[model samples]
Each structure stands twice: as C-alpha cells, then as structure tokens.
Target: MKVLPRQRKAVLINSVLGVAVLAGAGGAYSAVTSHSDSSARADARTVTVAKGTVLATVSGSGSLSSPSDAGVNFTTGGKLTQVNVKPGDKVSRGQLLGKVDATAAKETLAQDEASLTAAQANLTKVQEGQPSTSTGSGSGSGGSSSRGSANTAPTPTPSPTVDPAQLAQAEAQLTQAQNAVDAAQRAVDGTTLRAPVAGTVASVSAKTGDTVSGTGGNSTAGGSGGGSASGSNSGSTSSGSSSALSGFVVLTNPSGMQVTANFSEADALKLKPGQAATVTLNAESGTVLNAKVLSVSSLPVSSGSGSGGGGGGGNSSGSAVQYAATLTITSPTSNLRTGLSASIQVVTGEASGALSVPTAAVSGTGANRTVTVVNDDGTTQRTPVTVGLEGDSADQILSGLSEGAKVQLASVSASGNGGFPSGAFPGGLGGGAGRTRGGGAGGAGGGFRTGGGGGGRG
Candidate 1:
C-alpha cells in the first residue's frame, strides 16, 4: 500500500490531539471528586450532648478570724510588770493574766487606813465635845461661894468648850483623811490586772517591774484625786482618780471563729443569713472549713476599714465599693487561725439532674437562646430553648430541646455547612446527633432539693 507523506502527517496530528483531550477530561473528573470529599469532611463535626448535673456557685475571697478578738490594754500607765500568759496559753475566765507593781499601791492603802482611823477619831472627839480647861484665881471661888449663900442658886454659866471653828476644822480634816484612804484602796486594786473573760491569751505587751501609770501617763495615786502629791504618799492623793482608768491586762476569747468576706454589690444580693458556705485557707491547702452566713451589711464598709482594705480592693484608685458579709464557722479546726487568708464559695443556687448541654451548642442574638438540633438526615434545624441555671461547663436546658435531640457542636462553614449534611447517610443524622439520647430525669425543679430523681432523657 503506497501512502503519501502529507496524509501520514495528518494522521499523526489527530492522534496527538485525541490523547491531549483524554488527559484533560480525566483531570477535571479527579478535581470534582476531591472537592466533594473535602466538603463532606468539613460538614461533619463531633459533638456530645448528654444528661448530666450542673451547679451554680459564687466565689469570693475572705479571711479566717476569730469573731471575738479582745484588745486588752493596761488601765494604768505603768511599766508592764509581768506578762503571765504567752500567746498560745489557754486561760480561764478571771485568771490572773499579769500583775503591775503594788509597792506604791500597798503603801497608799496603808496610809489611807490610818488617815481614815484618825478622821473617825477626830470626828468622834468633835461630836463628844471639846475638853474644858479651867484656870481661875482663888478670889473667884470665894466670891462665888458668898454670892451663892446670900441668894438662891447663882446664875448658871454654860461650860466653856472647844471653839466651834476648831470643831469644823477637825471635821474637814477627817473628811480629807477618809477620801485619801479610799483613793489608796483603788490604786491598790489597779495593780493586779485580771482576766475579764475566759479565753486564750493572744498577746502580752508588758513585763513585771515596769512602772504602770493609770491610762493617761499620770501616776496611779495622782489619778485618784485633784491633789498632786510630790512624794509617794498614799493619803496625799485624792480619791476620784483611779476609778477612771482601765485594766492592765487584756484577755481574748478565741473559740468563736469568723470569716469576713467582701462581696460585690451583685454577689451581695444573692447572700442571706444562714446560707451555707465553705472556706479554704490560702496558707493551708486541702483543708476546707464550713461556715454559715451570719450577716450581710446593708451598706458597704468604708474603704479603709477591713483587714486588707474593703474586700480585696487594694489596687483600687478611688473608694472601692463592697459590702461586708460576716460568716461564722460551724466548726473550727486548730489549723484555722486568725488573720489567715481564705477563699470562699457560696452556693447561691444548685440544680441536680438538670438537662444541660455544652455551652458551645447554645447561640442566639440578644436575650433569645436557641440551639441547632441536627435531624436524622444530617440536616440541622434551629430550635428555641429556655435556659436555666448556667455553670462553667454546661447550661441547664429548661425547655424546648429534648434530651435525645442531636445538636451541632461547631459552626457550619460557608463552602460546606459546618453542621452535618441532610440525608448524607441512610440512617438518622450521624456525628453529634447520637449524643442527644440521654436527657436528665424529671423531678420537682427549683429550690435546693436533695435526692430527687433526675430529669428524664428524651
């Protein structure tokens, strides 16, 4: 067979063109298939919806301290003579905590007694009548006898007694002496500082042999009266001074432990008397103390009042606003001490067996709450849900969506909706849809109730 060169060239060109066209078609098909696969993978997201419990809690910081902290100070301004109790010593009520120097006090007391006795004696003598001293010449006696003989009884003459002015002066001296004695007795009492109530000894300020003057730097004796006695004379001082001063010793009762927590205005509203609380010391880990809300102040404490400024407001520029909540520990452990830092969590409200979902599932605009429930065919439908107590991890679904309803976890993408596609598989919507089976059991809702059957699953 004889073929022309031109014809053979034409045949070769056609064959090359056919091969190129086939290659292009195959590439186009591969690209389409890859795009579909990627879209399917993007649409499906793994989510979990289940029946579980959720708790609502409020957190706050506070300090662990004894409610009754007694600040004991010395009545007199003397050198602290003796501190009988140490910081940790447990003392009984009326125990002898310490004693101030009684040297001046005893001396003063003795002088007061002597003055009182002298005053009493002087008063008695004045009342009885002054002694009469008679010094007369013999002529007066003879003349009196002749006159008496001539007539009836001679004109009776009143006995010359002590001067009334002298009597009054003696009485005044007696009163002064009595007052001195009383003042001395009081000074003696001020020397021994006793415990006013039963409790532990938190601190001791003074030691023995120290000069303790009454409250104001005045001498104990001087405190009693207006008279200023230069030397140590008990009777020289007046009576009213010592009674005005305070006791030398201070005793505190440490059994009643309390925690002061500052809550913001928002948190303060939720708190009420008798609410349960748990306290944990920052110093002691793993130790939880129980307490109850004793009181909540209607008005916030002034900025500088609390231990570290009002309720953790140290860094605040202006006056920090906070209300003081007093919490009394139901039981105090030895580890719990005054001034220890603590954190508290008060359970404002709690709901057990609540129908809850991952916080991510819920979305909406404004106050409206809604969740996207995936149907059996991989399609997602938005459903309105009534939200209840919400916690850190989950939210309580009060109504709308049931327990077993499938919900899309992540958002749908533009190319392929982020949720499961409709009818992708023969069975119901897969992926997160499977997780929505178990809804919480049903029971009376609201108001902390224990042991109620959980809400039912869808």
Candidate 2:
C-alpha cells in the first residue's frame, strides 16, 4: 500500500476539478431559477373591451319530452285487470286500451239501481191518493172477550192528490238515486281504460295483475318511462337532463313531435309563449332544430326547488322548483326519439350590432359597474363604466369606456411557473390565458364563457 508520488499528485488534481464542477452547477441552478421567475412575471394579459351585438338568453336542458296534455291518463285509479294494448300498438278514440277490476263498480251499480227503483215506486205512491181505512179484530189474552171489537170504515178525508212537500221529498230522493246510478255506471265503464284520442301506444307498464293509480283522466299519457322524475336528469349531456314517465301507457302522435324541458323560475319569467328558440338533441348532435317557446309554465314544477339558471345550465339538487316549458320543433323528424336528451336556448332578450367588451373586463354590480383599464405604463386603473348589456362572452358598453381601451384582463406573476401555464388541471395555473390582444376570445379561464347570450343592461 505504498503510493507512488506521481499517482498521488494526479489524485489531488482530479479531486480539485470535481469540487469546481459542483460549485459551477450550484451557480447555474440559481441563474436558471431566477430567469424563469422573471419570465413568468413579465407576461401580463391586457384586453380591450369592444362594442358588439349581444343576446340575453335563457337556457334550459331536459329530455325531448311531450306536453302534459299529450298524455292519456286514467281519471280513476284501480287494479289493472286486463291490458289489451302493448307498446307500439295504434288505436283510435274510444278504443279499449286496457281494463281494470270492475267487480266493485258493478256491485255499486247494482245497489244504485235497486235504490232508484224503490224511490220511483215510493214517488208513484205519493203522487197517487191514499184512502184512510179502519179495521177491528177481536182477541182474548186470558179469557174470551165479552164482545169483539167492531169493524169501522171511516169516511175518507179526501186525501189531496197534490202533496207538495211529499212530492218534493220523493222527487229529490228519486233524483239522488238516479245520480248514484249514473255515477256507478260511469265508474264501471271507467274500469276499462280507453283511448280518448287516436295515437300510437308508446308504452304499457301495467300487466294483468298490476294495480295502477288513475291520473284523473280517461287515458294514459304516451311516451317513454321517463315521464316521471325517473327520467329526470337521465340521459343528461352537455345539453340537458330529463324526467320519467309516470303514465302506465303513453300515446304519441308521431307526426306531432316536440321537446319539453324544465327551466328555473327566473328563466321562466323571461320566457313567454311564441318566443324564438333553438333546440339541440344529444342523439342528433349535429341537428340544431329550429324551435319556439310554446309556453312557459307559471307554476313551479316542484316544491321549494329551482335552479339558478341563465344561459347554459339546468341541473338542480333537492326540492328545486322548475317551471315546465314546451318547445315546439318546427322540423322534427323520425330521427328525433322520445327520451332523447336535449338542450334549448330561448331568446329572452336580444341586442344586435351593439358595442361590447369582454365580460371579464367589467366588474362590480348595478350602477357601480366598472372595469380595470390598463394604462400605457405597466399599471391598471379602475375605470367607471355604464354597461348596457352583459353577455356570456362580452358586455355591451353603453357609455363611460370607449373602444380600443386596453382593459387589464388579469395580472400574472411569473415567480411560480412559466412552463405549462395550463397547469395540471383543467384550469391550469394562473387564470388561464385571458382574451388575447385579438377580439372574440372565450371558452377559457376555467371554462366560464358559454353562448352569445348577454344580460341586457339598457
């Protein structure tokens, strides 16, 4: 283990060189880190709030449903005894669709008939004169009576043929009995479910032994099982959600097709009958059907339940009241199927060819509306603004701010990350890129912007 002088000398040199390399790496790391942080801070996004046309719209999504009137429902509830029609069966008005257990109805009818007959006989006897007569019979309890009671015929106190009180009472009883008979007969007939109008049977959930509740109608509503909330929120897509069919049998007029959706109460207020709208189906995504707001229900769909909605939102948790809306599809075809998810946008208000700016640029509420304006220097000033209309993408500038004014969309700090600004998540790092210098940019920054709808300010 004796070391040579030259070899020892070489080891010392190599060790020194390794230490120098470590020192150099440490310096380089600091420089690189500093440069990266500076780069991130230098990138600030400045945007101009311009003027443009904006539409304030109310959007709602749900299954392409049917009008409540389109459903054929049973007016009376009963046990389903027979189902004559299955799904897809076509029938006409007054056609028997199914039958219920009518044994009870029949018994009720029989009793009513007997009562009616007795009432009529009593009435007849009252209308006719009755003579008073007296008769005596002899009887002995312990011993034979000394003399038998004598039979006597009293002179008839002429009975008035017209006894107004007796006549009225008898008449009322007869009428009541007749009503019972009619009601009982109707109930018996109701046991047999029939089609009130002609259409195709879309479904039949009731079997022979199934007990079905009456919808207080004579027929069943036609559609898929989604007529009830069972269909609610099902088949929901980016477009909307739907509800279930509570009807046992659904009848659909294939030629008459429409989409029924529920919207928040706020949106409902903006909607009115005959308003213009557009409907998009989840199935035929490419098909943007032209439609109109047939009606917006004034009543709340559910109790204590309504979703906050404006443009492009429809989900609601528990007890959220929604107003039902009917959209008549002007060009619905065979391609449109029941229970298909759909989204609709009703033009509650519109302002065309007006001045507008990025909605993000405008902040504050009501009369205190303002936007942050970027000065020529690397500084921003909050500028008072008179906003006319606010849209999903932009807001209409009524006054205060002028066109081409560079509004500070957002200020970014580079100390964190210069690389992968769109961080690991959907939102990325800092508020993702704002409206670039270019106009009409959105669907960015955590996916906030939606349709061209704007809240009308003026």
TM per candidate: 0.52, 0.52
lDDT of 2 by residue, 32-149 (tens): 4565555554665678655557877777887664432234444455777677888778787667877777888799899999999999999999888565454444445796664645
| Best lDDT among the predictions, by candidate number | 2
Cα lDDT listed for each candidate: 0.58, 0.61
State the displacement of the C-alpha of residue 227, model 2, in Å, after optimal TM-score superposition.
Answer: 18
lDDT of 2 at 63: 69
* lDDT (C-alpha) at residue 265 in model 1: 62
Cα lDDT of model 1 by residue, 1-458, tens digit: 87669989899999999999878866754564456556655755635556778765566787765534443444434555676788668876556666666776688789789878987887777777744555433245434443435445434444646668878998899888877877677667655555555665655544566554454223343232221111121111222111222223323343667888887666778888888889887887788888889999998765542221111112223334678888888865554555677898777666788788877677653359888788888777878988887665567888987767778764332223222232122122222211111222232221122222223212
